[model samples]
Target: MRTFVAGQEAVDETEFVELALGIDVDLFRGPLEKETAEERRARRDVAREVLRELRESAEAGDEVAGWDALYADALMRTVPFVRAARGQRAGTGVAA
Candidate 1:
């Protein structure tokens, strides 16, 4: 894909954000493309871990600047897509 900026052509980078949000990874498969129990469990695990770490850091009075710095560093090395192994039945279509 391509985009124009100031009348100059540029590579379109919109997909990167979707990858960061894991939208580019297909977590569901099989003939029906339905999410399975294992996928739901793994998502729950990740959510719990993230929440636990955030709560712990907040309770410890960690400085937001410090956390932001670390997060930024991690983002710098972020992969386009990080997904579970293939052939694993996963994904829960849950919403916030």
Candidate 2:
């Protein structure tokens, strides 16, 4: 993973490492096995919907705006897969 990230020359590597480490694993885990029905519904938020659109845009080669939205918030920004296209734009460069 580091090697892939090292291919980019524009980033401050430490920040990526930090964000990677800071990412909440649950975000990638989807619904937990023990989650109550209400808890599951609560996780279905506008933010997740917005993130979904950004993910689609990224997949579609719409890079700039997509990266900005994904990288704009702490919640979505730390997603591991996002690093694959992190430098697609300078992004917000702000950690939530």
Candidate 3:
């Protein structure tokens, strides 16, 4: 697989090279950075608000119209995670 370094220009996936003999490579994906306390609180707040909305919608028999809102809420919860994973995958590099 191709190698990368943080802050470098992006490269096409087809251009990745297989590792050579004796090379050391580490692969990491997902959230590589830690969230600050304030960010953590914000995420929790969003989650709680979404769950509350979902419960209210369920109680109101509004399931049909609730999915879109729930999906949007889910996206709000995960977009940062997806972005972080992409950044980590693109930024991590071989040390060999």
Best by TM-score: 3
Candidates ranked, most accurate by TM-score first = 3, 1, 2
Clashing pairs in 1: 39-90, 39-91
What does candidate 1's lDDT look like per residue over 5-44, in tens digits?
A: 5455544454443334332222211122434568656754
Whole-model Cα lDDT of every candidate shown, in order: 0.42, 0.48, 0.44
TM-score of 3: 0.34
lDDT digits (tens) for residues 6-65 of candidate 2: 454324565565354432334433323344446645654645765677678778888764
Q: Relative to the unseen true structure, what is the C-alpha lDDT of residue 58 in candidate 3, on a scale of 0 to 100?
A: 62
Error of 1 at 80 (Å): 23
Off by over 4 Å in 1: 1-34, 63-96
Model 1 error, position 82 (Å): 23
In model 1, where is the ten-residue run with the lowest total lDDT?
23-32
**Reference-based TM-score, model 1:** 0.32
